[model samples]
Structures are given as C-alpha cells and as structure tokens.
Target chain A: MLKPDLLIVGAGPAGMSAAVVAARAGLSVMVVDEQPTPGGQIWRGIEANAGTARGRALGAPYLSGLATVRAFRESGAVYWPSTRVWQIEPTLRTYVTGPDGTLMIQPSAILIATGAQERPAPFRGWTLPGVMTVGAAQILLKAPGTVPAAPVWIAGCGPLALLYAHQLVRLGGAVAGFLDTRMPAPLAGAARLAAGAVLRSGRELAKGAYWYADLHRRAGRYVRGVVDLQALGTDRVEGVRYRTADGRVEEVETSLLLIHEGVVPELHTARSLGCQTRWHAGQAAYVPVLNEWGESSVPGILVAGDAAGIGGAEAAIQRGRLAALRILSRLGRLPAGQEGAEAACRKALARALAPRAFLDRIFMPRENVFLPDDDTIVCRCEELRVRDLRGALSCSVGANQLKAFTRAGMGPCQGRQCAYTVASLIANVEARPMGDVEPFRVRPPLKPVRLCDVASLAEEAAPP
Target chain B: MFRLLEQGRSGEDAVTIDLDGQPVRARAGETVASVLMREAEAWCRATPVSQARRAPYCMMGVCFDCLMLVEGEGLLRACQTYVRDGMKIRRQIGARHVVPSC
Candidate 1:
C-alpha cells in the first residue's frame, strides 16, 4: 500500500494539471484513470490519435490537450493507467482494481476530477440499435477513427452535438439532418455574457465561432426549434421524426441517430463518498458543493473539473491548479507570501468560467426531453418506462422507495443513466423542487466488478 | 454499421477472433463493439424478458445494452473490452442464468 501526498481520481485536463503542479512543488502525487491513456473523454487517445487527419479535423480545442498531457507525463507523478477506483472511504483509503489486481492506498488528500457525462435524454425508440449519444459517436471517431455509416442524423441541442456534426462532416461522413431543440426565445443576458466572453477569453470565443461557422456551412439539413423528437425503428433506428416550431411534423430517413442534450457532472463517485451537493439551476444538475479552492464539504477531499460543475476543459485546468496550490499551502510547502500568484490564479479561473452562463442559456435542453412520454423507457438497465415510474411515484415521492418498488435505478449502472431523469420526473410529478428528490445511495463497486475478482482480493492483500 | 477513415486509422496490427464460432478480423487496439459494428453486427444482446434485440447505444460503457458472453468470462461489455487474438465471444441471448430459489 504505497501512499502519496495527493491522490487524483482522473487523468483528464484537471487531474493532469493538478498532478503536474503538485509534483513540481515537491508533493508526491498519484493519478489513476480507467482509460489506458491520460486524457479523459475530451482528449481521449490524444497521444495515439492526435496526429491523424481526423484529429486535426476535430479542431483546435481538441488538439490543445497535447501540451497538458505531455507536461503531466514529464511531471514525475506515479500514474496508474487502466485502473478502476471502486470505492473511496472517508478515512482517505481508496480501493482500486488495476492491471495487477485489487489494491488500496491511503492518501493525505484526494481530488476527484472524474469529469462530466452526456445527460441521459430518453425518448421513444432510444433503445434501438442504431441510436447512440453524440458523445459516443465522438468517442468512436476520436479513439478508433470510426464513423457511423452514411445517412447519419444528429439530434438535440448543445455545443458538443454541433461540434460532433462539424467534425463528422470534416471527416467526410454524411449527416442526413440535424434537429436542434433549442427554443428560439432570446436569452436575457446572452448579449452581455457574449461580450464579456470576447473581452476576457477571445481565443476560446474565436475557436467556438470557427466551429459554429464550419458546422453551419457544412450541414445542409439543419432545423431549429424542434420538438416531440422520436427515433423510429423496431430492432434498429431507421429514421427520426420531429415537429418543427413552424408546426409541421417531418421524418427523415437515417440508419444512425446521434443525440445529445449537453452534459452534467458525473455524481455517483462524489455522492458515494458523501460529498454534499447543491442543485445548480443554470445547468439543471446537482454539483458538489466546493469552496473557492475546490475543497468539498468534507475536508481533504476536493473536486475539480466538470465533476465539480459544467465548466469546460480550460476552467477545469485552472480549478485543478488552484486546488493543488491550496493543498501545498495547507501542507506548509508554500513560501511565506505568494498571495499575488494565488490571486492571479483565482482571477484566471473567474475569467474562464465567465461565458458558461450564456452558453447554458443558449443550449438549455428542452423540458420535454427529460419529461418523456409514458411509454418511453426511462431506465435502460431495468427497462422501466415512464408509466412504471409514475406508478411508483403515486405511492411515494422518494427516489429510493420508488427504486424498491419498480427497480428503476437498481440495475448494473446503479442509476448513472437514469437517476437524473427519474429525479426530475419525481420532482415534477410531486410538485417539489428537483433537489427535494433524493439521489440514489450509491454503494461499493462503483463500476461493475466481477465476482471472481472480488473473491480473489484476499489472496493479493498487502501485509500490514 | 461503421468504418474508419483510411487516412485517420492507426495501421495497428490485425488480429482474428471468434465471434459466435465465426472468425472475425479486428485491429489490435479496437474494441469488440467497434469490430462488430464494422462487420454490420448491430444486435449485441437480447433483453431478458422479451428477448428483444439491443446494441451498443452509449459505446462509452454506461449503457449495458452491449453485453456479450466472452469465453470463460460469463458476460462482459463489448464496448469496454478490447479485441484480442483468438478471443471467443458470443451474442448474449435472453437471460443465460437465472437466480436460484432462495
């Protein structure tokens, strides 16, 4: 059981940044990631796939991770790649299953930068074979250079969806149509926020504008103000049907349907560790409550990156550096006075996060996406539909009790895919704040662990 | 079904694996779901109750729809598992094992 001063859970932009900063400051750091590489989903396979034509087609934001990853590799941090952290105890003991076997480590401080996940927006026929998330499509392209067969249709509203469409077109993949669900109503503060973004982070604004312009020019069948969207198929997706704001229903033929409604913090690991979270209205998700320096309600356990909230990769990196500096200061490793540096970091983080409110306003997912029809399957693991959940809701408002009755969130995923949708539906039906609906209590083995592996743990235990 | 862009591919070593008793070729670093999709095998597993077909929807391991039976491994996620030489895999039919009476 080798212990380190700081144990970082992810090797994304945030975790990698923290490792580099802390290790450079003479603090021992250990970073663990499930992927074989350091880059989280955003920069996945960056080392192996970055130089390819498809990678270049992904644009500047995707390529920007190369320098961060290179710095982390040279920081002399102990990186455990292809490792899965199954449980985190309050005593700072983290249990992980890696290439060797099950092992545990005790770190003085823990930082969870596990990152974000695409929000689960269930709709009719979503379980069909050819239906997948836009993030998933991006993953295939980023990792393996694979593209869905021709006649692919993308749906939903978010920057990621548009980015994926732009990348796909750049890669010579055909997009049959794109259904944008953003309502046309003007956002109250969008203009002011956009201006602030341009003033503060001109490079990011310009990059985003470039992507938007490229997508607009390449994608021909782009429709806005879409509603009542549904994938049409029995065994596999064959087409998509949606109603436009102009009050006309249209169906487009397609073999693959990619959907996205933005992303939310992946909260199972944070919640399982008993970190207090607050419902964020802007992102419509529950974000872990963290102080200015990224420390959670529970001392010694910090959260950064999109896991802390919906901040993008750049903000994640800034937040990670800030957390590392605070840890160093708390450990008496910092010099007598470096307030200026600390203040500069804080200001940079603020600038990085300045544009999020405007983006959230523009890309907010429509209410109907989460509020599925009675027949639409809400829980993919248990195959529980909205009607089944509504039946459970009639008897109780608590998500845990509803789980007991209908087994909505009790499957292998442990509510990762359906918890948000279930919680939102319960809150809407019970006429209570979304926060009032309690999240499912996540237990050990956060990831699916084989029974054999668990049983063999005793043989590989480190001697005291 | 999907295919990789010729110029974007890594040119990784190719390996052959058994898929439902048939030999299928896959790249060394490619996932089982990627190989399946390349071969036009859309349905990965079937639902327990109705035996309805399902495929890899998330492809990032969140969706359990891509569950498949690996030789000696019982059941594993096709999207999560990388392809290996001589690997034996089969489409997971409706519930293969039932819970015994308590």
Candidate 2:
C-alpha cells in the first residue's frame, strides 16, 4: 500500500494552502478534485483569457489567488483534477481513477478544503432556463466573457448580488434594480459569534454600502428596491413581477433572473469521513466540526476552508496553512525556527476569519423570502410540487422521514441537485426554521462513478 | 448538448444602427452580441430571480440570457442571429405592462 505524508481532498484555497505549507516543510502532499480546475466556485478563473471587463474590475483579490495557486502547482505537490475520490476509509481507500487512473493510498494526514455553494432561491419559474445564481452569473462572465446583452435586472441580497450588478455595468450591461433582501434590522439579533470573528462588522457593512452607492450612480433611475419577485415570464422568462415596499407592483419583462441568497459550505466529503459536525446558524447548514488546530475527531484527518465554515478565501488559505503547521508540530518538527512560521500562520488565519457580526446577519437564510408558492416546482429533479412537501407535513413528516418515503435525493447527482430544495420546501410547509430541519446525510462516492467500476473494487484493493 | 456555432464569413458592407441616435457599426450577419462584443455591449442580460444581473449565459442556444427587444418584442437571443440595418435594438429591461381593453 502506498502512504503519503498528507492527502488533501479539494483544491480550493484551503486545501491548496495546506498542501503548500506541508509540502514546503518536506512532507509529501497530493490533492484530488472532481472538477477540471482547482479554484473552487468563488474563483473559477477560466484559462482561455476570454476575461470580462467585470472580471478585470473585480481585481486582484479575486485574481491574485491564482498566483498562489500557480506557486502550489510548481512546488511539485501532486495535482489530480477530474478525479473523484469514491471511498475514503479510515486509513486507506482505493479509487478507480487518479490524475490518470485509479489508485489506492494511505496518508499520515488528510485535509479537506471542500468549499461553499450558493443557496437556492426557489421562487416561481426560478428553475426556468433564464434563471441562474449570482455566483453562476459571475462564472458565465469569467469563463466565456458572456453577460446578458439585454437590460438585465438583479435581485436578492448580499454583497455578491451587488457585486454582480456592478460587474455587469462595468461589462456594459444595463441593470434594472437591486432588490435588497437584507432582513429589516429587527426580526432577530446578530449572533454574538459573528462579532467575535476576525473581521469587524463595521468594515463588511461599509463595503456593502459602498457598492450599493456605486451601483446607484452607475444605473441611474433604473435601480429600484423591491421585496418580492413575483413570477418571471410565462415559460422561459420574458419578464418579472417585482413588488415594491409600498405594496405596488412593477413588472419588467426580461429574459433572465440572476438570484442568490448566500454561500453554504459543501460538507459531503468531510461528513463521509465522519468528521464531527455542528450546525452553523448563519449558513443554515451543518459543517464538519473541527478544532482550533483544524483537526477533526479522526486523527490524521483535518478540515479547513468554507467546509469548516464559510470564512472566505483568505481565512480558508490561512486555515489550510494552520492545519499543515499542526501536522508538522505533531511530528516533533515544531518549537524551533518554526515558531516564526507558526505565529505568522495563526495571525494570517486570524485575519482570514472575518468578524462574524455583519457576515452572520448577511448570511442567515430568510424563512419567508421566495417561499415556494403552491404549484411552483420545489424539487427540480422529480418535478415534485410544493404540494408534495405540504402533503408530507400533514402526516407530520420532516425532511429526513420524507426522503426515504419519496426518494427525493436518490437521483445520481446524490442530493447535490435536490436536497437543499427539498429542505427548503419542508421548512416552508412546516413553518419551521432551516436550522430546525435535518440536512441530508452524505455517503461515499461523492461523485457518481460507473457502477461497473464500483463493482470491480475487490480486484483493485490495496497492495499487501 | 453544447454545439459550437461558429460565425460565417464577413458581409460585404457595414450595416449601421442608431444606438440611442448615435450611428453604431454592425454587420449583416453578426449578432447584436457579436457587434456589441466587438465594440461596446458587454453586459448582455440579467435574470428575474435573484437579480444578480448577468449577460446571456451559454453562448450556444442553451441559456437565454442573450435576449433583446426587437420592435417591442423581447424574445430574441442576441448570440444566435444577424442584425438588419436600421433595426431598433433596445436593451431589454422587463415586460411592458399590458392592460385589458374594455
């Protein structure tokens, strides 16, 4: 059996940061990812050089990481993209593919930097072809230099939504309005936890207000604030019904609907290893529970990045470096010249962990906004209606109980395509908070592999 | 599902448009997207969902973010066609309110 000094799952900021530190410290490191590229969703810098004007405007912070990513690549750490880690056992797990083909290995340490996902906005016709996520829109702009040429309207809340609007303007696209989804400052108190993090609430809020002003000037007379996005178009999105705060309705017929709530860390792989978990009130999702040192309950396995919780790219990278430092310390390599490195890493990690107050308030998923109307398709996969979720609620069923009964998440994408939608439906129908609802339990084969390859596993077991 | 549609040969003459009354250069066979991209138009479309303003997604016919209004109608994909001379091309904001006539 082959064993390395470290095995990292995911190639985002966190995973790459950890690998760089550990490898530089003379530890063998290997990174495996399911996509063709390394930068996670937030930073999908396509290599074609078909850069957009907005991408150029978003500037260095979004673009600078690639330099670090390039350094990680040249450092000789193994890079395995487009390879899915089907099963991860306590010590060693065999997979049908590596950078080129399937291999098995044991590692002294495992760092998971699996990152975040944008929350779903399940309003009427949101699933239609014209609708997409804010992050997804940025992706379309970056990868293909494409943005809707028609006057596009932006909705939802969060710093990202506005960022997209500004980027659209920078790209020469006209915008209609910025629907502020910020919960009226009264419903709930900011979690004290958000205040205690690395960044100050004042700074984050200031940044958001700055962008809104910039957008206001750039999109003169067009930027309207609304509370609800009623149905958009008839079939594929010809227009949208936006409800103003005064209870008046304005309808704009546009072909696209770019929406998002906020990002939630994808925790499937971390959970597959049985990392201890805790529910994040802000994200409204469960995250792999890890200690200050980034160690999971299982020895040799560590969690970092948004997978630990959405701390942003800077925090994710520092946390990744911290995990490597912890691993090196355990190997009796610390307490010397490494002290300088250790302090630097921890402080960098500190900066990365933004103050939670504003972020917490910014992220907490709304229980009411975009609530699925009756007849709106809740589960995009099975075309399950909101009525179906309501039916389950009448029988006193919840997300977990209903999953086994309805096979909502049994499709090949393995809940990636359906779980959140289902969870939200149940939450809406039952009049409960998302935190109160149980999330889908993630199993192995994080990516779907051919069944034949999965069945031939016995012949591919580890070497004696 | 993703078929690449390449642009054909350039037309013989420069077709023009009064973009908000300023003469803009376009081509006979070029899409509003191709013309705008070759010159000024970059942000093509936005969605009705989150309002994360976006350009037309999937330059192929898949995502309909490239739609623009042609003579009061708002269902044309900018990336999928040619522009005619003197055509009124306005950036699509949303649908105009239609009232029922007595």
Candidate 3:
C-alpha cells in the first residue's frame, strides 16, 4: 500500500492545480494519471520528449503544459504516469495500476478531479470507424499531432463542436460543412443563450457577431439540425445526409465526421462513494452534489471540476485548489482562514462559470436530444437502429435493459456516445425525468487504450 | 479571469500581457493576468467554452477559451500565471490539426 498526504485522482488542470498548490504548501502529494504524461485529456503532454511542433501548433494555448510538467518535477510531486486508477473508495482511498501492476493507495486527503466525457448523439452509419467524437479527434491531434484532412464534417452543439471545425479548417482539413446541432432560429431556448452572451467580454461579442455575420455572408446561412452519417468508403465515412430544421435533407460526401455535444462529468466514482447527487438539467446528467467549498455532503470527501458539474478546465482548476485548501484546513494541515479562502474561491468559481452556465442552459438537451430518425443507428457497435430502441422504450426498459436487448450502450466506446442519446430518447418517449433513466457506471480504462496496453490495469475494476 | 486588463487584479502576478508587441516588465509578485490585461492585447483569447466575450472564464485554466499561442510555447493559461518579459504571447482562436492518429 502506498500512502501519501494527498492523492489526486487526475492529472488534468484540476488535479494538477490541486497538487501544485498543496505540495507547495508542504504536503506530500501523489497524482496518478492513466496517460503516459501528466496533462490529461485537455492538455495531453507529448511523450517521446520530442516536443514536436504538432502539439505546439494544434493545441495552441495548452502548449505551456511544459511549464506545469517542469513544476511537478521540481516540486518532487509523486506523479505516477501511465497509472490507471480503477477504484476510488468512499473513504477517499484508491486502487490504481502502475507500471508493475495494481496497487492500493491510502491518502490523508483525496481530490476527485476526474473530468468529463463528451456526449454522443447518434446518426445513420455513425458506427463507421471514421466517425468519432470531437474529443477523440482532438486526442488524435494531441498525441501525434495528426489531423485527418479528408473532408471532415464537424457536427453537434456546444463550443467543442465549433472549436473542432474551426481547427480542422485551419489545418488544411477540408471541412465540408460546420453543423451546429441546435436549430438555426434556435427556438425560444436561444433567449437563455443570449442572456449568457450578455456577460461576455466585448471582444468575444464582437468576434461572435463577426462569425455569425461571416456565416450569413459566406454560406448565405448558418448550419443547423441533424445529419445522417454514412460510410462512403469501406471502413471510414464518405459523406453525410444533412437535414435542416424545416427538414430538408441534403447528402454531403466526407471522409470523416467529427461529432460533439458538450460533455458531462465522469460521475461513477462519486456514485461509488455513495455521494448525494442531483441532476443538472443543463448538462443532462447527474453530478455529485458539492458545497461552496467543493465538499461533497459526505463529510471528508470533496469534489471539483466536471465531476461536480461540467465546468471547464479553468473552473475545475480553481475548484480543485480551493477544495484542497478547505480539506487541508479541515484536516488540520492548515491554519484558520478557511472561511475566507473558501469564500474567495466560491466567488471566482461563480464568475468564471456564469457565462458558460447561461449558454449551457440555452443549449441544454431538449426533449428530442436524440429524436433518432427511423433508420438512424442507435448502437454503433451492434448497428442497432431507432426501431430497435423504440421497441425497448415501448417496453419501458432503460439503458441497461436495452443493452441486454440490443447491446446499444455496451460497445467499445462504452456507450460514452450512445448512453445519453439512449437514455434521453427513452426518457422522452416514456415522458419520465432524466434522473429516472439513471447513468451507467463507468469502468476503466475510463479512456479506452489498446487491450495490450491496458493489460496491467485490466485487473482492477472501476467499482461500479 | 484576469487575462484581460479590466478583469485583472492588483498585486497578483497572474498574466503576462505584451505591450505594443514588446513584453512588459512584470515582476513575480504581480499576476500575469493583471499585467497582460493592462497591455494592449487585453482581448487575450476568445471564449467558446466559457461563453465569455473575452477568454479566461475561470482565470484558472479550466475554461480554456482564454488560450493564447505564446512565443516559444503553443498554448498557456493566461489567467493562471504572472507576466514575464520577452515572453511571446500569441492568441489562439484554434489551430490546424496536424499528422494522423495511428
């Protein structure tokens, strides 16, 4: 058993930020990350130590990850790279797989800074190899700086979808079209998004207006509504069938289809700890219920970042540090000043996430988050379609039940993309709350690496 | 949070803002965010994630809309660090995807 003063579960901005702060304050800190490097998914550090230009160019601002890596090395922070942490106990203990094998770890305090997973909305022929989430696409670029240039169509809602499209266009990838998952008129729900827009800095508003104007100017329209993805080639995507809001369907040929619809925090660990949770209507998922200090209702345990809710990395980083300060204070590692520090962090958290919160609510999944078309495939692996899912819904079955019937959410991506669509469709069809549908437990590798690579960690279950 | 000048706070070395294409003199005690916001490039990064008109929604790096392609670096969290002289800070709207995933 390895013991430390602080055991950080992720090495992303949140976990690393927490580790840096706490370690600087003189506590022994240990950070275990599944990836070979410390930056996690948002800031994937290049391994070969080559410092390739690939990461520098595409990753943009996160390139400064080198500095953070340097800091960790200097601080003597115990960073177990390539360590897949499978189980996080309620007592804030953890079991992880290191290079040699699985190991149990006990810490004085633990920070659950595990981040979020992108939501997957289904379309026809989406099961094809070339069709992947924007997150997955970004990872490809991050790891080896590889951007597939074969006519990509980025589809779905939220910032990520646009971000991917914008990047793809710049990187010589021919973007057949940029599809915003929301309706063009945006429905009445757009008012909420406009409200969120009100708080944005003037520059951003100007940029947005410019983009909108540019879209109207160039394409004579903005991209909106659902699209039917198809494999134009043998193994990859060849084109897409775009259906506008009024319901005009157009076939567009493409080599790749990058889809993303915001994201939800990875909540399995929180659930495993038996933490009280509430459904965030905006995020369309259940998140650990945390307090102002980022503390879970479960006394010693604290939560931060997307795990608490789908706040971005900046919010997660701040919350992680603040949570640490509070936990340290509570554990008697630090002096009084707990109240003041917590107050400050809370203020920062609110201000940082406020703008996004508004947008999140506006872009919140609707009753038809996945009004899957009649022939749209619901399960990518099994190639199950809406008809199959409808049968399950008619029977009043849930994601798990449907999985048993159709294997919709049990594929390699672990239903990361299909689960929500399935649950939402089920909920909408059944006229039940999303909470009733419940979330499927997430087991490791939270990220699906090669089976051979994950051999060591495979022994440890994520403890659903 | 403090990536832009108006949003920057005093006494904290949060961001490094370049002045007229030249890096300003920022000490460790002051936050790079504060100093960068004071510089001409106050509109450090764009906000797609945070929905902020300006970037650095969390000022901590979680809300990554404030990402900038700095000189000698690809992207850095402007709100998280203090300013440094001669530092090349470039704004990153988005970057071109390179290479292919194996």
Candidate 4:
C-alpha cells in the first residue's frame, strides 16, 4: 500500500501539470497513467520522439509538450507508468493495477484528469477493420511513426480532423479525399462566437486557419456537407460512400477510412465517484459540474482538463495548475492569500478556452450522427444495432433502462463507446430533454480487474 | 495495410512475434496493435455476442476493441500491450476462456 498527499489519475497535460505544481508546493503527489510513458494522448510519446525527425514533423503544438513532460519528470512526483487506476472509493482509497500487479493507495485528495475520448461516430460498416477514429491514427503516428499504406479517406468534421489530415500529408501519407460533414452554423450565432475567439484566442484561430489551408492545398478531393456516410467492405473497409452537398452520392475506393466529430469528456471515473454532471448543449456531451477552482461537486475531489469539458491541451494545463493551487491552499501547503499564480492561470485558461465556443459551434456534430440508422451498430461492444435499441426503447425511458432491457452497453467497454448514442436515441424516442436521459451508472472496478488481482490485495491486507 | 514511416524504420530494433501460430516481424517499441495493423488480417478479435470480426478502433485503452490472446494467458488489449520478442499472439474468438485462479 502507498499513501500520497494527492493522487492524480492520469498523466496527460492536466495530470502532469498538476503533479508539477502540487509537488513543488511541498504536497506529496503521485500520478498513475495507463500509458508506458508520461505523455498522454496529446503528446503520446514525446520523450522518445520529441527531438527526433519525427518530432520536428509532428509540428509545433506537439513539440510544445516536451517542456511540460520534462518539468514533470524533474518535479519529484512519483509517476507510475503503465498503471491503471481502476477504482477510487468515496473514502479516497484508490486501487490500481500495473505491470507489478495490484496495489492500494490512500490519498488526501484525488484529481481525475482522465481526459477525453472521441465522440463515437457509428455508421454502416464502422465495425469493419481499417476504419478508425482520426485520434487513433494520430496516436499511431505519434508513438510508432506509422501510417496506413493505402490512401486514407477522412470523414466527419472538426479541428482534429483537419489537423490530422494536414499531419498525414506532412508525413508523406496520401489522402484519398476529405468528406466534410459539418453543416454551416447560423451566421449570427457563429459570428458572435467568432468575434470573441478573434479577440481572445487569435493564435489558436491562426493555427486552425493554417491547417485548413494546408489541407485544402494538399488533399485531392474535398467534399463538403457530406451526408449518409458509410464504409463499404466485407472483412475490411475497401471504400466509402456519402452524399455530397450537391445531392449526388459518390463512392470512392480507399482502404482506410478515418472519422471524427470532436471529443467529449471521459465520464466513467467522475461518474463512479458520484460527481454531479450536466449536459452541455454546445459540446453535446455531459460535463462534470466544477467550480473555478476545479473542485467537483464532491469535496476533496477535483477534475481538470478535458475530463471536465472539451477544452484542449493548453487549457487543460492551465486548469491543472489552477486546481493544484486550490489543493495547496486547502491543505495549508501555502499560506493564506499567497496564491498569486491563480490570477495568471485564470487569464491563460480563459484565453486557451476562448476558441472553443466558436469551434464548437462551427464543428458541432450534424443531426444525422445522433440518429444512426436502424441497421447501424450502436453498441460496438454488445454488437447491438439501432433496431435492437429501438425495440427496447418502447419499454425503457432512459439510457439505464434501455441498457437493462437490451444490454446495449453491457460489454467489456462498459458503455464508453455507446452511451452517448444510446442516450440520444432514448431521448429522441421518449421525447425528453437530453439532460433527462442520464448516462449509464458507472460502477467500481472502472477498468476490468482480474479476480486474482483483487484476491492479492485481500491477502496483502491480512494480518502477518 | 500499414507501414512504418522513415523514422520508424531507422534506429529501432526489429523483433519477430508469432501471430496466430505464424511468424511476423515488428518494431521493438511499437504496440501489438500497431504491429497487427501492418498485417494483412487486421481484425484481432471476434465479438462474443455476434462473432463478427473487429479490429482496434481507438488505439488508446478506452475502446477494448483490440483484445487479443497473448501467450494463451488471457485476453489483453493489444493497443495497451507492447510487442515483445516472440510474443505468441492469437485472435481472441468468442468469449475468453477463463484461466483458473491459483
């Protein structure tokens, strides 16, 4: 068993930044992440690849993460790499499993920086091989410096989609085409957000503009307002079909199909800890309710980074620092009113999050995404189709009830991939507000734990 | 279906791992899912419910779509598991056969 003043349950931008701040302030900090290295999905494998040719090609945004990773390594915080924090009890006793086996830790405070997962974009033949999320492809490129040999046809629309397309081109990978599924936002609403973004987040806006221009310059076919997207294949994705903006359905041959519709805060860890959350209509996801200090509804528990909302890495780092300052003050590590960095962190965080509203409005998921066709597999883990869920919707009122009736979310994934879609379907059928359809009730053993691991913990606790 | 970029092929040591009783070469630091993606048969598992073939969706841990039987031990997420020298990997079909707890 281990005891630390604070236990952070991820090693991403937020977790690493938080560990650095808290440890420097004389609070014993420990970060446990499931990756082999400290860089979470944002920097993925920065330590090994940061100064290499691959890093230079990955561009500035990724290279900027090297400094943070270096600071975290030198910060005296204990980092347990390749460790999974499967459960956190209300008592603040945390259980984690790793290469060494299972262990328990009791921490004074817990910070969940688990971050975000791509919004599940289910469509026909999505389960086939060679079809994956754009984020997955980026991870592959970062860690292993690999790319699909076949030209990739990217679908859906978001900043990540364009950024990845540009990165793929930069890495000498060919893009078969880009099928943009974004619908034009109302000019008034979009303009209002754009004005704020330009005023506060001009740098981020400039970067997106660069990627957009580079992608258009390099991509062969750029199809906008794409609808009814589907991958075509028997064993693996061999082609894709989608209706173009001009109302013509086009089919293109491509072995790889990448999709993205932005990311939503990962909710299992927060939900399991019984934190309160509400649906964010703008991002179209459930985000945990948190104060400016990053403290959640539950005292002694804080959430930072994309796990709280869809703020990207820069904002996540700022939030992590802000959370650490609050934790430090709460624990008396810092004398009262000496927290001078809080103001700077808040300003940087606001600026980092400025572009989000405009991006969210412009890249919001199209209406068709929520209404996956009857034949589409809503639950990839349970292999449940939309029709199967619809059959159970009549007898169910919400996501939890639908799960009990159809077992749509009862597989190894525990509903990470399907919860949003299932809840959306239930909301549409039940004619209830999206917020009324609560997500699945997350249980303990957040990650699948081996029975032997649990038994080992029990034996260790026995009187010797 | 996937190939290592220029930097991936240089400097990194290569190791061979067995995939479904066949030998395949892989980079040392690359994950089992990355190695499997380069193989012709990319699907690593058949769903327990429908027995339909599935491959790695999210290269991260959240999506358990990359489950594979390694060394006949149990089903492990290939995306999370790194490729090692002579790691015996097999496509996990249907429900995982539970190994007895000792």
Highest DockQ among the candidates is held by which one? 4
For model 1 the TM-score comes to 0.95
Give the residue spans of candidate 2 off by over 4 A. A46-55, A90-99, A187-207, A220-225, A331-335, A369-371, A424-436, A455-459, A462-464, B1-102
Instruction: Please give the C-alpha DockQ score of model 4.
Output: 0.79
**lDDT for A143 (candidate 3):** 38
Top TM-score model: 4
Q: Per-residue lDDT tens digits of candidate 1, residues A167-203?
A: 8888889777778888764755777877777787787
Which is better, 2 or 4, measured by TM-score?
Answer: 4
Which structure among the candidates has the greatest lDDT? 4
How would you order the candidates by DockQ, starting with the best?
Answer: 4, 1, 2, 3
Computed on C-alpha atoms, the DockQ of candidate 3 is 0.02
How do all models score by TM-score? 0.95, 0.75, 0.70, 0.97
lDDT of 2 at A457: 53
Q: For model 2, how does the per-residue alpha-carbon lDDT over A101-163 read when each residue is reduced to its tens digit? A: 556777877787877766656676665656666776675565444566566666777767777
Better of 3 and 4 by lDDT: 4
The DockQ of predicted model 1 stands at 0.54
Give the lowest summed-lDDT range of ten residues in model 1 chain A.
A455-464
Model 3 residue A84 distance off true place after TM-score fit, in angstroms: 0.6
Clashes of each: 0, 42, 44, 0
Cα lDDT of all candidates, in order?
0.84, 0.64, 0.61, 0.88
Q: Score the docking of each candidate (DockQ).
A: 0.54, 0.03, 0.02, 0.79
Which parts of model 4 have CA positions greater than 4 angstroms off? A335-337, B7-11
**Candidate 3 global lDDT:** 0.61
Judging by TM-score, tell me the better candidate of 1 and 4: 4
Residue-level lDDT of model 4, residues A285-366, one tens digit each, is 8999999988999989999999989999999999999999889888879745555688889889988888888999999898
